[model samples]
Target: MMPLRNPKHAPAAAAHLSRSAGVRHQGTKRSLSAQRSPAAQRAAPLNLEIEQLREKGNAAFKAGSYSIALQHYQEAQGKALTCRPVDDDLQARILSNCAAAQLHLGQPQAALQSCKRALQAVPNHTRALGRAVTCHLRMGGFSAAQGFIDALRAQPLTQAEANTCQQSKDALQALVQQALARAAKAATAEEGVQALAALEACLEDSHAPCMPSLLLTKADLLLLLDRHQDATRMVLAASEAAGWPQERLERYSKWVHAHMLYSQGQLDKAATAVSEMAEAAADDECRPAPALLPSRSAFAMLQQAEPQAFRDLAQSLTMLHQAKEEGNNAWRRQDKAAALNFYTHALEGITAPPPVFAAVVFASRAAVHRADGRLLDALADSLRSLALCPLYMRGVLRLGQLLTDMGRHELAAQELGALQKEQAAAARAHAVNATCIDLWRDVDAALKKAKEGQRQRRAIDHFEVLGVPRTLCTDDEVKKAYRQLVLKFHPDKALGRCRFSSAIHTTCRPSLAQSQLEERVRAQAHRVFSMISDASTALATRSSRITLEAQLNVAQYRTASQQQPYSPGRYSGAYQPRSSTARASRQNAYSKTYSNDYYDSDYYAYERFWAS
Candidate 1:
């Protein structure tokens, strides 16, 4: 017979069972001891209870009740350890569960540490490895996260588990590659800022490859942010990093060197570096996409000589437009919203455009507004286009002219004035011939006539007080003539000087009694001056020569009435040799000249000439 087995190792075989069967053998030592401790007896039952709790915890965790499940698992872990020594595998499993709970609770740092502990206990624990990778990555630890991913991939897991791990690892690999690429190519200030953000994220995952790309990116960003020295140091470090191709390293080195030169205002060196980089990039099979060229060109342009720099910028803008068009063909498909966005971007790169294009843009926006029933907004944009380029005369005249036809005189006047000023400025700047000015003057005269006709229909000839017709009077003449009449009609005149007492009493009655006659006279004078001002302003702004002539006739008549000689042609000399002082004094008075037109025999006879 084999040596007697230890009682602890025996399977259901007890010495008492054999003795009770009456088959006791002499000289055979009993292996089974009858002195089993109470602690020993409780151990198996305690283990069974702990296992039950563990199962319940797992169920709860799967059901998404992480808090409840954590409590149950913790209790189970305590009981399991108390009953019998817990093995490494069991400890790792417990810790993994806890880490999962922590992760679910958004405590990434806590989850990271807990998962790390679990990995320490059982390095091959697949769940712990996966969770650790996730935690690290979440905390921006790409390298360390990648390490965990590699370990997970190497494990002999079930098909589903293997697939999950592989997928996750692949995604992380892509992210790492992108991050590394960004870091390596960061050659400008903006790139450096981006690299910094990427690096900060990468720090969480320590196991990630410290790619040369990251360093390059940092250097580039620093250079862009004007940290040339820092960028230079980082670039050198990156250049020394292993695994990068010689061509790539050399290219990045050139770019960094050029950036350093450029930062020091070394345009020539920068240009040389840029040329070399461009050649290398162009010849290389791994050139960056053309979409990136515009921005690079823009940067390069900044290092160019002044005038050339502007030209380069303009070229870059063109390139940008080309790239944008290539990237977004849908913009050409009559998609209004998309087209609007595209045009808006393009517009930012330029100051002004030819009138035709400006009109189109304005018209497009106006159409949208009109369709939305925002007539005022639509009108405003259309008018703005006119203001920008009044050469779009048809559009300007139609919109405002129609508004005026619809009795919106105020809006029409505003639009007309804006168009006229814009056109005038453009003509002046572009060295338009004198004939154009004459033409503009003619148009201005026409618009004035229209405005005067409108004013006349309003039942007031404010400009008539100065003994002139509504036409041909300069601003000076209107003001001067008004002052002279005010003196003649003033109620505060000496009793002997009050020639038209009955007229004053009738005109300046209850509303403006004799005591307030001065105020009324001033008010009437202002009204007359305002009319003349409007006429002058309109004459200076009309776009139609035919209309302007009509306006001049009205002005000429008004001018004739306001002067001493009362001759239509007298005021012609007033503006012939214009002087600043004369202009100022004329503007200060009610009328600076008078015409005989309003003093026709019939009007004077009606006033009943009385000697003072």
Candidate 2:
């Protein structure tokens, strides 16, 4: 006889049926031996063999050796069948176990066949019904799975089995929808192909959201047909909708925006974007579409048009601004050399700066010059700043202050007075708010000081102050004159005199007012001492003397038109000039000698030559 297959639970149930059959045979063989049927007698030994086989199968199944377990269960089922009468319930369970083992072995077809037999043996078998539902769902039999589900739900079930049945039903419905969606997608693809074919047949115009492949193919077809312009347009549109073309569009928009910012003079923002774009270009993304490339577009017209070059410019500008900031901080700390170095670096870094930024830097550098008493250089820078940006208030104020310090007080007064009037008029006409109120106050004070200085002006030539002629004085003569004067007006001599006066007045305990008056006198002495010191320093060198002589002549000419007369001071009486004929000859020779070769410290190597 052919062996019957078993599945899960078959081994345990068969083992139990064999034990009960053994008990009945034991009672019959002992108490009713003569009356016992031959078949019953034969079934007793078969029952014992079935029990042993069932135990081994159960162990194999528990150990996860499903093939071995299935074999043992099959043998047990065969032995059970050879008994006098078969247990229908036991037969159903063993067949269900066989289906389970087949399911685990990935033979759903065979498992389903075993399940049908199990259901036939006991029509209301729950395990067989559940297993059959799973097999149909796995095979994509939605309708068949639904039939099994309905049958599963009708049977009496535990909570877990009922939940599993509901899950299977849900899965079946979802699979049906998925199949339908896949079919519709396939149809759509076919329709797209047909539409392209029809367009090719018509040889006419068309226009998605369509796949890039289809669009590219259409573009090629148009090209082959010699519709060059249409082909180009189609290619552009397709690129705009897909691939690297979309990325190019975004990049192009950013470039345009940055260009606009640059045009509006928003340098920092535009440069920052250029730097970020350059960094992003290092990625492995495709090159921009040829038509959208900057070199092929209007963006190429911008300054520093290449992406890498623009990024370099941005970095350069950032460093320049940082230097400018450092210069400003150094100036605030009163570090003149450090401030000048940083400002010079900032200026040298940019070959062409925006006029507004250049104007501001120039004015700041002029402030450094004015503080160092290089009035000619200060004047030049301040004027250049104003030339670059005529409305720069700080530059205007610096120019006024520089002129006053240079003793062109009348001119300083005139320029500042004009600026004050112009600003007031502008404020009235344009309703322009005064943003530089403090600056205006400073300008007002400078104008007042210039007017006062103009009234009491003394034409004290630096050369004359050192008891030397304007021209033809040798460095030795200049040095000799400076030493002779230093003995009288040196800071050390002035301090000693101040101490002597204070000691003399100490016996009389001077009041606060008297102390303040003494302090003012000392301050006035130091001021004169500094002026004498600067005069000596300027006249000590031939180059500086030449430069200063040129500056003085310019100042004299400026004052000559005003007809300002020179007033004799205490030092003026100490100086005597050479004969007029000799002086005149030397002056003429000096003018001709250094006129073209003179260098301005503001632009040339003033510090290097000065140090030497």
Candidate 3:
């Protein structure tokens, strides 16, 4: 060997080696690579470059610069792999350091890969094994973590490393305990799917054989989920599935057997069956640390109390079914009377039957009544049915028919149209198997006809209410009329000055009825004041005034079509003015002047209090 030259050449190799040759490698009497082959000598740094890189990586890692630390570690790992001996402690240390950085960076999967390579180089590498355990735990690979933890613990460790091993074991145990607790909670919460999922998740992970305890819990949770067969398969192991050892299988059998007995409705037998198992588990110091089963007295109380609830529920259900059967039979035979009676009985039988069943009875009775041509009764029942279940297709169909029978075709069609959307949504969500296409087609046809036949209700004439001419009014005219009316009727003006007639003291000189009458008059005055306020609001703006004018024209046209022509001349001698403004002023004085008219005192008395 020609005394292998340093692989790295500085600006001046001779000067660099002269200074560093003794200083960097000074502690060693003989170089660790003194007798290495030329290839081995060239593969690693001769000076201290790798140590420098590790120092920089540590600094970056400690500074919360995870990404920078990761880059530094990766570079160190690359150099060590390519430049150092394959099985050197330095090679394992660099790879394990890379894994620690990766773990902290939230790249546990990547960290596992690095740890595996480190372990390959040095099988007893405690740091690498511990890092691998952490990575597995991070990824929910409890089985894989257990293997690393066990392997790590098997190796000789310093006091600190031993503590690390203990901590790792405790962490893995805590994970097992938490998963079990969560599974138990989910089961008790009646979240069956989630409970089964939690069990299947733990059972499927073969590498992280958390403990015999988790597997036992899986069997119990499976039973709780009503998965008798899966519970059996999990505990006994299927033909195609890998089985647990015989001793372990025996430990799982106690819970599985008790679950089977429980499934047969043998509550007492099930409770007794699991008692020994729980006791034995507690004896073994198993986690979550088993608690004793409920005592016999608790079981007795449950057994005593459960029957009354079950009987009440069963009786109601049975009576409802009986009523429904009678209705169905009567309906099929065209006995509308009998069917109506039976359906009514079914509807009234339960105080609160399930909404679905109640809706069915209501709709069924409505259909019977519809066939009998009692449209009002049918409408009542159909409305009740829809109230119970807005999405009840039968109720929707019946309600539309009932409404159509009642000559409310537009409302009938609108209601059915709304149901069409609900049906389509139900079908899309897979909540209903029947497609809504046919129903929508029928509803759309009905809606088109109903729209054409729809009676356009005339808008209430605010112009008449405010005593203004429909066509002659300007914004100022409307506002002026509104102000005069509100002034006459405003509760504030009438509150203290108003007088009550003797007729208001109906039963006595001043009885309870008289007080009530006084309050009623005050209420009436407030209401008239509100109406005057509403009139003001209606004509407050130009757009609103225009809308009011159009409404008054339509109302007048409708009134003219329905009645004989009004005679302005016939009422002229009795005195009505041309302009509504002049006419409105007379009407405003009508209330105040006639406040003393005293005609049909019983009827005219309350009017003297407001409306000027």
Candidate 4:
């Protein structure tokens, strides 16, 4: 009964149920539409932000602030990623910006990675494709860049982007043509340098175009220009870029390297370089040995001669300088004994044969004599020193002073006068001189002293100076005397080298004592030493001894012609009268004057004794 009653209302109930279902469906639809509205609103703001970021990046790029542009683009990229899904085109743009910045910054590897990522995001993206092409080219990936360029051309791109790709290819072609044309011109005209420059120049979007042939050519050109290291670098770089075996490439580069080393006059080093390359090559290499170093029997003569011809004199100088330096260092330390000792030893070791340096040391020793009141010794040293180097300014000045001190004032005046003339000539030539006035004063003072002095000191004859028999001494006897003197006074032995006796050591320590004698005695001893040196020099040579004996005989004569000017040796001057009349009238007075000089009179007596 209940079921029958519900049947009548079934239609209405079914209609009510259908209406309820429709209401629920409409609510669901409204809820879904509400969710969509918020997302759309969020999308607008996010897209605005992305656009703003992109615009900022573009502005920075336009301002030449590529690094700033890269930062902005990166921020945009990050933000895009923060969204539900990233925009491929936007990511691509960001990546392109990043690559462009990195490329300009000379970070080709970083730029290449960025471009790769960009191309991955939007394979057909025109700007991304162009950046990848440029990056690949920069990193020297010629084939890969060409592939990318082909892909980019195949893609649908804007007119401006298409123009960029087309221009890059066209410019690359132009660069190659230009380089090749320049190379041809250089080769034909022997302009190797220009050809090298052309070959080395890179196109804006092209890999290094220096092939093996070009590198070899440039290396030859560099060798011609005397750029050995540069040529080596070029050759090595070519070998590496070619990805060829070292042995295969070493032949050309090695020869070039060896030639360059040889051309630079490094023959031994060139040989060493060849030997090294040859050793590295071993049995695996077949290249002929480098034509640089020759170690043959014939070249051995050159090696042998090199020391005698080139380095012998230099080596001798080195030794001489080293010895002199050692002596000077000791002298500066106030070790007078050690200094003099070293100076004398240094003189003995000199191999250059001339006593030029001996003169200087003698002059130095003369200072010690003056300081010790050994005036005669100082005078003697002065004369020898002057004889050795007349032009030595210190020696000249000092000798003049000594001559004045020793009562040889006229001779001092004459010596100083010659120096004055030279100094005047130098001044006339506009040479600067701080010592001019002082020198003039010195000369005037000496001249005044000479004018005041009554008589000059006596000069020594050679035989008494040598302590040998005057008229006839065999060479052996002379040698024996010389050996004895050298043994006693060799500078290396401090005791023997001192000019004065041990009695001076009692007055002052030997290290500080040059002499204990009075000024007159010291001056006499100094003259004796000079005469001894002259005797030794004369006796050392048979021919020189003959010449000396002749001079000595001529000196003994008192003829009027003997009044004529007598030239002294290199380092000393002779005592001369002040005027012509004085010189002529001195004939009778010569023997008397030189009797006091101690040599001529002693020699005259000795000559008579020997004649008997």
Each prediction's RMSD over C-alphas, in Å, is 28.1, 31.6, 23.1, 27.2
List the candidate numbers ranked by lDDT, top first.
2, 3, 4, 1
Off by over 4 Å in 3: 1-153, 156-322, 344-355, 369-391, 405-410, 419-449, 452-612
lDDT for 212 (candidate 4): 41
Better of 1 and 2 by lDDT: 2
User: Could you tell me which 10 consecutive residues in candidate 1 have the lowest summed lDDT?
Assistant: 503-512
lDDT of 4 by residue, 462-564 (tens): 4444556544466788888877765543334422222322110111111101121223333434454554566687676544444455444544453234456
Give the Cα lDDT of each candidate.
0.47, 0.55, 0.53, 0.51
Q: Candidate 1, 574: how far from true, in Å?
A: 46
TM-score winner among the candidates?
2
Return the number of clashes found in candidate 2.
5
Distance (Å) between predicted and true CA of 590, model 3? 29
TM-scores, each model vs. reference: 0.26, 0.34, 0.31, 0.29
lDDT of 2 at 60: 84
Better structure of 1 and 3 per lDDT: 3
Residue 447's lDDT in candidate 3: 60
